[model samples]
Target: MVASSILSPAIADSLYAQSPFHSDQHDARTGKFWMTSHPTEPGDNGVVPLMKHWGGEVASMWVRDTELLAPLREIGRPRIIEIAVPLATTPDSYSAAKAVVATFGRSIGAIPGKGAFDLYTNQALPPSAVLAIHTEGDPTFVAMGRTYPTGFVDVDAGRWKELTGEDD
Candidate 1:
């Protein structure tokens, strides 16, 4: 099924304003800032899945659940959901991780079933930087969180990997 929720780019920027999750406006291909990483679900203990996980660093810019539900209705609000909120970030990946210390409540690995990850933005409309979720069949779940000023794509993968990983 398709996602009911849609992230507005303008709104997402405000959410991560001054934060590190900010992506490079310039089109310079350095690292996999826009690629997928393989990792088990959050809290999987060890075994990370060989799934291509890709998302963004900004969000819908809504602090309250109400403001974020209209778009949610479009996707039927399934049981299992995986959320990733990009926080502030530095120039490099390693530095970005270090900056995340000040931010804790970012990126959530939720569990929601009967759906899949579909809602996305960016030039290619692929998930990047903020608020990402998907649910597709069996095992309903939802993990929603926001990162600090320092955030990176890899770090985002490792932190949320536990949703389906076995190695703590």
Candidate 2:
């Protein structure tokens, strides 16, 4: 089924401006950031899932609902939903991931070659819970989900390759 709701870029940015999440350089990429929620105390875990139900896509290997809130203190939670926000048609993967953090929220991962990533919040268009952004346009189209865990894994390229059976 298609997503029923979507946010525009302006609204997405506004919401992020009002939230408490913070961004930091990812360990893998020097200039790339990993926007994350402060898990000082338990607040609400429903926000991510609710966004997914509203049209976010499940977009990151590191984004788990269980660990989303307390990222620093934990890891591995049920995969959370993420909204994909378009940044550019030709920007590098790092630029796109940075945009997701600065504009939408922490990026779970960047869309392969698409100038987009799975943003935790503040996404303009709600993508299918099970789809990826198919084409870039107003009310973007979505197709069956395709997992793209880019920049985040580059830091541990060796480990990732061993685990995923990739050859250098």
Candidate 3:
């Protein structure tokens, strides 16, 4: 994991919505709503195009781990957003991690102590994986998750609570 920064969910949401490729569509196969990019290829999910736009080589998973939230909290950033890219080799993962850190770490704020940005790459991820943005205190914002064919840019509040069983 590289040292990284933080962004409030509101800011993240705004940035994502303002992105040129944003989309909101319901997946009939999974019966879920997604705010994501349009598919780059016909009959293809949006993962490939999203990764390309986001500067990731292959499909990746972004998770917010509760365990890593402490260090960020100490700096007054109680929320964390992680990006996990899947690669074919360990070296590739490391390089990708560095790229992610370089590309996104600066725009957000840096972690004060020990640099707790946890960006990694997985070698075992299946095709068309979902990437999620997880936060600690904000239950109203659950960015995205897998169990679907395409990647997601954001998810609405009602759907988030419905999926996670979280109360407002």
Candidate 4:
């Protein structure tokens, strides 16, 4: 995935091993599940958004839907790759921040944590913008000069153009 900071291959491997998907909470105060009261007990499971099978489906959907992306290897069912990227000054560029999320944001099961690619700023996105790439593991590729993914950053699209000397 595209990262805001350059990352070592070893580090991405460890993160993948720990917990790939990121998570968050949504307030449904009027609904059936809400953390209305503070403390009846400590180990309480609240009404939280949930995602299952973070990486597996990410891999599968990348295989199933897009010709743009494919598994780095023929053997591995699940894998994680890290790419070094430039500073995505605009937020929409956040999409470019991570490759896995870029390749399969939809087909993958519920996003991990806030979900896949949650580990980024608002505009951080992949596609269209220029980026430097680095990868470890099986070696997945993202097209920097081609069409962007459906969710690639729009938040910073205008700003990015302004900074890069494009018509805003």
* Winning model by lDDT: 3
Determine which window of 10 residues in candidate 4 has minimal summed lDDT: 34-43
Model 3, span 1-168: residue lDDT tens: 122445455434544454334323212212222222211121124343333222121111231333333233344322223323344423345544554564364447532121222232324444445444444344422223322224432223254465568876
Q: Over 4 Å off in model 4, which ranges?
A: 1-24, 27-52, 55-76, 88-119, 128-168
Report the lDDT of model 2 for residue 84: 38
TM-score of every candidate: 0.22, 0.20, 0.17, 0.17
Clashes found in each candidate (C-alpha, N, C closer than 3 A): 67, 1, 2, 26
RMSD to native, candidate 1: 15.5
* Candidate 3: pairs in clash: 5-109, 132-144
Query: 31-71, model 1: which lDDT tens digit per residue?
Result: 32332222224433321111211122222222334444344
Better of 1 and 4 by TM-score: 1
What lDDT score goes with residue 158 in model 2? 54
Cα lDDT, all candidates: 0.32, 0.32, 0.34, 0.30
Compose the digit string of candidate 4's lDDT tens values, residues 1-168.
426333345544544443323212113111221111111111113211111112332222223323222222322232222322334432334444454453354346423221223222224345543333322222232321112233334332354454567776
Scored against the true structure, residue 111 in model 3 reaches a CA lDDT of: 25
* Order by lDDT, highest first: 3, 1, 2, 4
